[model samples]
Target: MKKIILSASLAFILFTNLKADAQIKLSDIFKKVTEKQSTTSTTGTPSSLEIGQGIKEALQLGVSAGADRLSAKDGFLGNLAVKILMPPEAQKVEKTLRSIGLNSLCDNVIVSLNRAAEDAAKEAKPIFISAIKQMTLADASNILLGNNDAATSYFKRVTTAQLLQKFSPIVTNSLSKVNASKYYSDLTTQYNRLPLVKPVSTDLTGYVTQKAIDGLFIEVAKEELKIRGNINSRSTTLLQKVFGYADKKKG
Candidate 1:
């Protein structure tokens, strides 16, 4: 009887301890879940909408800045990096002209080319914004985590055709407005008449239009790099959050 009673008491003790232990474990789980919920509410990951919009906004700002800077007077002419120069085929023409004391003519052609580029750059902002608005969510996500110039590369890819079509007419008009077409024709005519020179028939409008587009992309790439690498370049909360997550992912 004593043994039986002792066994019952021990079982009761064990049951009580088991109940206490289960309660403690359950409490711990609840606390952990609550803490996790709090952390998530305070600092959650950015959603697809935020990521997509953030990338689009950044591109918009970058492209606008690029267009504005390049459209300014002396914008292309003053910047050695993006300065329009004589096409490769016409380098010899330029040299010959310069050697014959036609330096003024050569200078005029170069200045006019850059001037046309600057004039056409004024139309870039709206086209770029339109292209950016059409970007897919997948593209935005890829650009957010891709290389520093990924956004620039995507922009170039998607907008090049439209830009070419859009810039050609403007560049042609700008060339005329700036007297580039006349100067180029006069210069080429002079070069073509040189003894034993192959007839040069370069398309000045096409060359200038292509070069102007290239220069704009260079400026856009610079801005994209700045936004990706420098935290301060993220001008909005969404940009901060989206790129901040990218920073961590990269690290």
Candidate 2:
């Protein structure tokens, strides 16, 4: 009977220890889950206002930087990626002119074209700011979660028509100011005078306007991608918070 009682007490102690161990293990798991939830809740979601401001700030920064860079002297001329080349229809004109040793004229036209584009780029900042101001909360939210070029795509969709309208007059004025129009006319006249060669007529103002807008958009896209992917490019606390959430979502 003593042996039986002893066994029962030992079994009770063993059962108590097992239950305590299980409870401790379960508590550890629960603690970990709670900690994860707390961390996520605190850091994973940005407020709607923050979302809007963050997106706008990012776009503004990108467009402003792009506009500034392109507006500077040699911005377009120096950048092969954004350089405005002669229109496809005028390529023959340039080649023929260069081949015939009218290299200076060709160079003048090229330089003047880039100069016109650079002059027109100065107008992009206000226009971009206007478009950025028009962005809705929903738009900002979608852009925040969208692809790297999402903001640039948004800008293109909303601002292309306005940019074209705004840049046309500016480019036209700049073309005259910079002598691009005259050089182009001279180039075409020289090319057309060559025997057995077809005449080439191009809308110089229209071409420069479109190319300038394209170059600005390209620069903006690069800036957007940089900000989205490079944490070092986040130049503000708001950017860090907004993009930090985006980073976790991607992961």
Candidate 3:
């Protein structure tokens, strides 16, 4: 009778141990499933607002950087890639002036043109930021996946008309303030006076305005690339999350 009792006790304890182990295994499996679902919900896909906001944020940063760089002294002059040279229509005038002893005058005109551009660049910040504010959800998606300069191109394409309207007047004012008008007038006057040279009447304000816009786009592209490729350049959590999706997709 004692042997029978002992056997029964052993069987009960064994069954309890087995049941506990099975419960533990089931709990671990459930825990793993829950963890996976949480991760998927959090990191699966970026929403439309996230996409639009991220793009706007990136563009705003790019515009700020571009405007700040170009508006400062030496911004246009020092940046060879975006430097304002003599307009194509006025190239002959520059050549003729350089051929003569008017190199000093030509140099002066170049410096003043760049100065005017730099001065006008400050005004571009608000105009560009305003344009960025108007970006649609559709535009944001294309820009996010676009090439290195895609965002810049989008910016230039959409805002150019308005930019021209606003920037032209500012460039006109800047031309006089920076003495670019005077220098260009002097250059052309000297060039026309020389023998066997065609009369040149390039629109100095228009030329500088166009060149400054181009320079801004270039700078913005660079800023965009910096933020896209470099982790450190993404300063905000939104930036991190938005661009993190891009990185995963690219990979």
lDDT of 2 by residue, 64-103 (tens): 9999999999999999999998889999889988998999
Off by over 4 Å in 3: 1-44
TM-score, every prediction: 0.81, 0.82, 0.79
Global CA lDDT computed for model 3: 0.86
Candidate 1 lDDT over residue span 1-251, tens digit each: 99999999999999999999999999999999998876554244789988998899999999999999999999999989899999889999999999999999999999999999998999999989988989999999999999888998898888899999999999999999989989988999999999999878789999999999999999999999999989899877678888888888899
lDDT of 1 at 139: 95
> What TM-score does candidate 2 get on C-alpha atoms?
0.82
Task: Report model 3's TM-score to 2 decimal places.
Answer: 0.79
RMSD (CA, Å), candidate 2 to true, equals 11.7
Q: Which candidate number has the best lDDT?
A: 2
lDDT of candidates 1 onward, in order: 0.91, 0.92, 0.86
Q: Model 2, which residues run further than 4 Å from truth? A: 1-42
Clash total of candidate 3: 0
Identify the superior model by lDDT, candidate 1 or candidate 2: 2
For candidate 3, write residues 1-251 as lDDT tens digits: 99999999999999999999999999999999998876654354688899899889988988898899999999999999999999897888898879868898888889988988898888889988988899999888888777777788888888888878878988898888878898889888887887886788987778888998989888988998898899898877677777888888878
